[model samples]
Target: MTRSAIELPVTADDRRIARLAALAIGLTLAEAAIPSPIPGVKPGLANIVILLVLLQYGWRAAAWVSVLRLLAGGLLLGSLFAPGFWLAAAGALVSLSVLGLARHLPDRYFGPVSLSVLAAFGHIGGQLALAGIWLLPAAALLKLLPVFAAAALIFGAVNGVIVARLLAGPVSSGRQSGSCTPPSIP
Candidate 1:
């Protein structure tokens, strides 16, 4: 869908937001390229953008940006239907949901770190759920929860810090400018 079709106001600010999303997609792809100890696990650095969009633009913008990132990233990487793609898609959906819910809470209530924790846990849970459905038995998947959780915690916190840094300036400026209000705290 075109930018105008998304119901977001077509001001310069909206264009700026779109540009930011594109940048986030690029960042995510770069993050994905970094080798990890486990093949499929990632730091989910791009999720900071997703969280920021959800906070600044609203869920619809966040969701659409996420879908765009997933599709574009998969196509660019040539991993559209690969197992990793499915895992990433599931994780993204879960992370988006968590961020959506978190948006309801006052910004000061949770902080970026806490939101990242929730998103990371949701991301890992989604992957585990997919694994159970498409490959392993539930019992087998359960065996890996500890490992996944640990990775999620570490990566999630890292992503959260990055996001917090990125948002601190823009969000505060937006608030001061009366361009937006902090989302309600859940």
Candidate 2:
């Protein structure tokens, strides 16, 4: 008996997301190189890509970029299923959820900087909550809150500024944003 092979078609949009994910993963690896006195206080350098995708493409593309980055980055760093991996996963979930909701906010009042700040808090909060539940006691987590919060706010704003600047620049001038619907998967 012979078995049939299944084929999946690749799209340009898929390629775009893959390239963005690879960039984000590269940033994650770069971030890992920085020394941090605190366990999870390193700047979220990778988030700049995600925020840019969210703005230039949409939340769905941004989410895809983030998911790919997490899986690939975890594998590359040899930290899959580790405590740090779980913490990052938890943080991504919360941050993505916040972005999903925040995307609905008005353009007049909200933009990348504010959204980034919000998602950063969500990211840190998720990590802290997970640490409190799986790694440390609530009280100890509380002791660590201020440091993490400060990191989240500062990093979030900085990443936001970077993304905002990149958006303002001619990074991808050929593409239309927000006003158009992203190409649907066939």
Candidate 3:
């Protein structure tokens, strides 16, 4: 069987989303390559891209970037439909939800750093909840909360700072005038 299509031209926004998603997936794959000393602790580098999307475009673009990363990255990492994927999906869902609400906050009070931290905590919360209810279903699993929380705080802050720097740098601009092109995939 062959597929047929009335080919539609991709818009600038479409190209931007695709590029951002590709960058996010690339970051996810890169992160996967680094061996972690702690089982559930990584820098969450992909989130920096998502956060940038949210800041530049909106929650919708960020959501697209996030869901695409979760699905595509999982497939690339050979973790699709696996326990890790579910956990990551759950975390992304909660983080996006939190970001949707938090975006309403004034920029002065809530910038990338604060937003990143909030989303990070939300991500961890969702993962822990899913693990407790579905995977382990034991109170013992809750014991890991503190460790995860600490990791979230540290990584979230770092990711937020990175995003902020990216935003301030020329990369946030639409053009590649300087050494760093804007983080928008296109």
Q: Give the per-residue lDDT digits (tens) of candidate 1, residues 41-110.
A: 7788778887777766778877877888888888888899899889889988998888888878886778
Which sections of candidate 1 miss by over 4 Å? 1-14, 170-186
Which stretches in model 2 have alpha-carbon errors above 4 Å? Answer: 1-4, 170-186
Candidate 2 clashes between residue pairs 3 or more apart in a chain or in different chains: none
lDDT of 2 by residue, 98-146 (tens): 9999999997778889999999999999998888889899989888888
The segments of candidate 3 whose C-alpha lies over 4 angstroms from its true place after superposition are: 1-5, 170-185
| Candidate 3 accuracy as TM-score | 0.88
- Give the RMSD in angstroms, all C-alphas superposed, for model 3: 4.3
Error of 3 at 82 (Å): 0.6
81, model 3: CA deviation in Å? 0.5
Whole-structure CA lDDT of model 1: 0.79
lDDT of each: 0.79, 0.87, 0.89
Worst 10 residues of 2 by lDDT: 177-186
TM-score of each: 0.79, 0.88, 0.88
Clashes of 1: 7
